[model samples]
Target: MDKKEISHSELKALIGKSPDLLLIDVRTKEEVDKGKIPGSIHMPVDSVDRDLALDPAAFQAKFGVQKPSLDAPELVFHCQMGRRGALAVEKAQALGFTKARNYAGGYKEWSEKAGK
Candidate 1:
């Protein structure tokens, strides 16, 4: 599926802006246990399809914010690096979200920024 991918800097800027700007971390809880970017929601890529199928609303609510209020949510998906994030972004777009973006550098970039 086609998607609009955003860089790390672009994503950092987009955070806390509006409606359904969701920060979706595609790493496992164990990985996240190491640390996660503040305000990010955990939704491992493996479970996304099933979870979305069972209860899209609940999944979206806990992990996503509705864009423009109950409208399409902007998604920023990340992983250890960028591979999984790209997959997640594709999945999100297939699910009908128009604003999904892949955080190509993922947590590594996040950690680097935090160090700075």
Candidate 2:
């Protein structure tokens, strides 16, 4: 199985059952001002490179979510569609977050299917 991406259904299941999962909404602030997946942390795609490098305490203060450790298994990124999310995942993986994954369907598919 490809480890670089996650399906919407898989993400939904994780939302229901995985306390450790981290859902990062990497769209622009304007796009996010409208809506995002429930419980996702809003971190725009531009800031991901800088923000993900912060120490845990600084990360929490800035993003209001605990920083995922280098190997956090359920770390996932999404955007309006999927392009930015893939880029975000690429940045994360490059920074040693090898377990980070893209939500390939993005919020379009999520909101349509999840009806939010």
Candidate 3:
């Protein structure tokens, strides 16, 4: 239970309820084509370090989601399992997204827990 990690149940509750929150899914294009958590913006893990450095407008145009501010409280990242998501969090924080968090259970737990 890392302080910067959110559980599936917590993420489910945050969806739609937290207007300031951004759900980021860092997975391969092919993997995401299968499915992702509803409302998640797809930004691949490899591109995170590059893309997150973009200015706000450019970031939004690229990712179709608002570029999270450096300190945005609910910038949550997830992947197939937990590892890549955690890596994404590290990248985000390195770029000053200090509050970025990992959905450590990732999509597998999310799908299973939600019976998707």
Candidate 4:
């Protein structure tokens, strides 16, 4: 149950190397409309707790994506800033996502450093 804080550079490298990583964006729909990390799944922070409670198959169907197994290598979450990301990581881990991590440098920082 390690909730690590992933740095911007580390996240970028991860994106390049780990296709299995589950990148969850916890930003609002309005905020997300501006732009988001290329492959991130949109799961706003407010909905995380509820969504994590759904059965795996149901969750996957609802999200239109594969549900991360409990032992999935990495389940990273992020928002406009780091706060919601951290919370989402906690919620994911609580729901048994062993490799949950927060991308502390969220969309704002990502856009600033990684040019979106």
Candidate 5:
């Protein structure tokens, strides 16, 4: 499988350009309470497999957001650092989200460059 990685700046640019993009925060709830990239959906890494396994309608009902289609334009995952985000992206891909990617810099680099 082809894995993709996005940098902070690239993700910011894509956010502006891609209407179909889905930004997922795979951090713990406590970590997420501190802060996160604006507009990111909070889906902890640990829940990804179970959540993505649900059918699209059920997934949306549970998460309050549309389930990304297999051909969704882009789905970017991030965590406090990068490891969990990479894992989340892999899980997304395994579940057939072909456009999934890891935001390698994650929230740490984002906060540094974009401010808290």
Candidate 6:
């Protein structure tokens, strides 16, 4: 499956189906320190540029785990809003992640979903 953009509702549905899906928080550590969706991996967007951008295999060997293998289990990226997370999804796809998607509306959208 090719990577593509995903909205908040779509991302949420994916999360429900695959709990072990790689939920990547593309926000900075400080930003995420405030709060983040549960079970997300902290893969700062910058880190991908430094190491993973240069050599993803090496990055995985050192800082990342094996790429998630489920087709429906997407590599979902989210930040405060959609832009950064959308960029992160593009990077992840460039780095050979076949199932990456952005969580547009991100944390704010997620919080709203939880309330509903």
Model 3: runs farther than 4 Å from truth? none
Candidate 6 structure quality by residue, lDDT tens digits, 13-73:
7665775667778888898898888777788887754544545476568656554543435
Which 10-residue window of candidate 4 scores lowest in summed lDDT? 1-10
Tens-place lDDT per residue, model 1, 1-116, is 44467777777777776544677789999999999977788889997665545465775576564322223456678898899988886786677655677888889988998799
Rank the candidate models, highest lDDT first.
Answer: 2, 3, 5, 4, 1, 6
At residue 42, candidate 6 shows an lDDT of 80
Per-prediction TM-score: 0.79, 0.94, 0.94, 0.89, 0.90, 0.72
How does candidate 6 fare on TM-score? 0.72
The digit string of per-residue lDDT tens for model 5 on 46-87 reads 999888889989988887888888877688899988999999
| Clash totals, every prediction | 3, 0, 0, 0, 0, 0
Candidate 2 lDDT at 98 equals 84
Candidate 3: lDDT over CA atoms? 0.91
lDDT of 4 by residue, 30-106 (tens): 99999999889899899998887788899888887788888787788999889999999888888887788899989
Tell me which residue pairs clash in candidate 3: none
Q: What's the residue-level lDDT of 15 in candidate 4?
A: 88
- Whole-model lDDT values for every prediction: 0.73, 0.92, 0.91, 0.86, 0.87, 0.72
Pairs of residues at least 3 apart in sequence or in different chains that clash in candidate 5 = none
Model 2 spans with C-alpha error above 4 angstroms: none
Question: What TM-score would candidate 4 get against the native?
Answer: 0.89
Task: Judging by TM-score, tell me the better candidate of 2 and 5.
Answer: 2
Report how far off residue 86 is in candidate 3 (Å). Answer: 0.5
TM-score of 2: 0.94
Q: Once all C-alphas are superposed, what RMSD does model 3 give against the true structure?
A: 1.7
